[model samples]
Each structure stands twice: as C-alpha cells, then as structure tokens.
Target: MRKSFCTTAILLAFGFVSSCGVAWSADAPLENSDCVKCHAKVVHENQADGGKHKTEVGCLDCHVGGHPPSTPKEDIIPQCSMCHSGEAHFELNNCLGCHQNPHQPLHIVFGDDNVAACNTCHPAQVNEIKDNPSAHGEFDCSLCHHDKHGYIPDCMECHEPHRPGQTYSDCITCHRVHQPTNVTYGQDIPNKDCGACHGDLMDTLAAGTTKHATLQCVYCHKDTHGYLPACQDCHGDPHPQLMMKKFMKCTDCHKDPHDLVK
Candidate 1:
C-alpha cells in the first residue's frame, strides 16, 4: 500500500511542473500597448505634448522592472535625474513646480517663485538684467512672466505708452526689457518716437528755421540713447583758424544744436 501511494505522489508532482513550464513559455513580454490598456490617459498626454520623451523614449524605457502588482509604486515612477543629468537646469529641485505635468513635459507652468529655476536654464537673460541694472530688473521674473513658463507680457500691461497708440512693437524698438534704461534704437526711428520723451526739445527743433529742424532725431542721436555729438564731428572747423581759436565750440556762436541762434 505504501509503495503504491509514493508512485501516485511522484506522478502528480511531475504533472504540475510540466503545466507551469508551458504556461510561463506561452506568456509574452510587456510592451507599450500593454501599458496603454491601463494607462490610456497618460499615454494620450505623452503622445500629444511629451516633447522629447514622446519621440525619443517609450513607456518601458522610463518605467522599468514591472507594473503595479509586481513592482513597487516608487520603482515604477522614474526620477527626472535618471535621464536629465549633467546640466545646471537639471539640478533644480521640485521639477514639478514649473513642469506641473510630467506626461506633457513641454506644457510648463511657472510658479510664483520660479526665477531661480529660470536663471538655471536662461542665464543669458538673467545676466543681462544683472549686468545692466534697471527698475525692470529689480522685480521678479514671475512679475512679468506671470501667465506661464514662456509667456511674454506686454509693456503696456505695466507702463503707459510714451505717446498715444504706441504699440508693444514700438516699445522693444528702443527699450530692451532686461536693460530698459539703456535705451537704443535704429536709424529708421522717427522724430515723433523721440518726442515721446523729449517733447520740449522736439517742439523747439520744429519751430526753428535751421537745417537740423527738418532732420530726424535719430540723424543726430544715432543708435545710442544719451549720445551727444561734438559740433566739429559733422562740421569740422567750419570757420577760419583765427575764428576757430576764438569760438572753440560751435555752440558758443550757434547757442543750441536743436535750434541754432542764426
């Protein structure tokens, strides 16, 4: 009776082992399609606006090992550092603060205090404000870029236009946002634009009968904001040597460059 029981037990054990081997062999490896079955929303978001992640990577690439039942929750969700390393921008903490959605990585949203993070990625813009100090530079980056990560606020939002109907395009023509005080413009700038600040001077030049009255403000001012040219630079020694020595400066006789006392 004992010999018969042992033979039966051996046969049952062999049968169980054979069945398990067949089942394991038949099972397929996990794929992105498999992940999409459970994580449809996440997959959709990634597909729509995941930036480099959508194009360069796959679901299995970031999330390794296995899914929830087999893998720990922490192990399934990969850290940003795993791929984004060796850069100052990558070193910033709490990436989710600005990049609120990991799936839609490029759809960034800036927090109230994301200036530090902004400086890491855009040091040139930050340095421009630092190198040339102004009232605009004193405020936080969020103050102006309050809407989103890459939002550019209109100058009219904070400042009234120097003159009526001056568009935002007109603001950038002379004022660099980072270094607004260090005003600069091109030769094409009209006298009216300059008159926005120098109203009295524009009026004086307009009323005068001198040749300077007909010329554009940029003709004399050139590219720089507060540039003052010497009278001799344009009219080099207009008078004889004897007269030049007596009246060393053109302004001495001419009185004012804008409206010369002819």
Candidate 2:
C-alpha cells in the first residue's frame, strides 16, 4: 500500500509542472524600481509636449494614488485628475478645462464655444476680436494667442519678422480674419463712404455742374481700399488735376464747389 501511494504522488507532481507551461504570457511588466526614480519630472516633461499627452502621467501616479507607488496593477490606482479635487486649476470644471489633453497637455487653446473662459483672463483682447468685424472669427482665440493669461503673440513673432522693406505694423491692415479679403491699400473700397473720412473733397463735388456731379464720387473712385482717387481712372486728363495750378481743376469750371454753386 505504501509503494502504491508514492507512485500516485510522483505522477501528480509531473502533471502540475506540465500545466504551468501552458499559461498565457504577460507583457514584460515594469519593475517597481524602474518607475520610482524619475516619476515626478516625467509628468512635467510629458505636459510640455503640445500634443495630447501620450504619456505625461505614469501608471504609478494614476494607479497607485497617495500611497507609495507600486507596480502591481492591483494597488488602488486612481485614473483621472478629478479624484484629487485639490490639484491646481482643478476648479476649472472637467480635467480638460486648462489641461486640454491628458497625454501631452501644455497648450491652453481658448474654447470657441466658451468665450467666458477666455474673457476671464484676456478680456481686452477678447473684446477687440469680438467687436471688430475684421478680427478672429469662431476659430479659437488661443490658436494664435498661444500663451496663458492674455498672452498675445505679436504678428511678427510667429510670422517672419517683418522684412526691412515692409512699411507697416498694422497686421489688421491686411489680415482681416472675420473676412479675409485681401484688401491692400488699393482695393475693395466704398467711395460714397469716402465722405466718412474726407468731408472737404465731398463738399466740392456736391456743388459741381458736370457729369461728375451727376455721378457719385464713389461710382468712379470704386474701392482703392484706402488710396486717394486718381483722375486718370475715369477722365484721360492727366492735366485735369494739374490744371488747378494753371486753369483750375475740372471741378472748378464744370462742377459745383458748394450747393452746385454755378
């Protein structure tokens, strides 16, 4: 009986070893020591990358929580920032309010649907863009204003520094975001509205007697953007304006100077 029992025990031990060889292989798990040495700085560095963090936060930080971090997956690891509730910028509603992406979150893009958020930090710029028909449209304001707390980028900073030949700093002069029609100093103008800026020239025409008097100044002036009108555009007379020096401009003899003052 004793001999039979020994044989049965030997067979059972062999069966157990065979079963262990067939189990699923796990990924090369991270050793606990490998994670502890540089955990905090890794988080900071990860956040620095502009893309949604591919790995800003480590498993130990999220999965381990307040306790000393362990590599064991079963340790009480937290998954999202909301659990802390005391983290800086935490009150910003969802974890994404300021930290847009969890994997590589550093950019603070202004939410297009939430102007109130941008207003909290950049009220002045917000107003300029909102009130001006030519400023940034629904595109997120932070798309250009990349920094935090009202950080506006100079147009030349992101674009090539204005070349020496460039004459102006008014980026708005051409980059009308609301409607990007390339309005240089020479196009897309409204002449009737010229009176809005040049009241004196308009007065001279309202009192003229010629075909020019019949045609509103804007009819021929068209939209030179902001340039002055040239007589060469309608009347072939290069001398018409110079005539003011010798015979008086065409307007003096043909159009009214005031109230059609003939």
lDDT, candidates in the order shown:
0.79, 0.49
Residue pairs with backbone overlap in model 1: none
Error of 1 at 211 (Å): 1.4
User: What does the lDDT read for residue 17 in candidate 1?
Assistant: 34
User: TM-scores, in order shown?
Assistant: 0.79, 0.31
- How much is the lDDT of residue 251 in candidate 1? 80
Query: Each model's RMSD to truth, in Å?
Result: 9.3, 14.7
Global Cα lDDT for candidate 2: 0.49
The candidate 1 region of ten consecutive residues with least summed lDDT is 17-26
Q: Candidate 2 on 62-133: residue-level lDDT in tens?
A: 445322222333555444653545633344555466656554555555454555665555577667666765
Q: Which stretches of candidate 2 lie over 4 Å from their true place?
A: 1-65, 68-91, 95-97, 100-114, 146-262
TM-score of 1: 0.79
Candidate 2 at 53: error in angstroms? 19
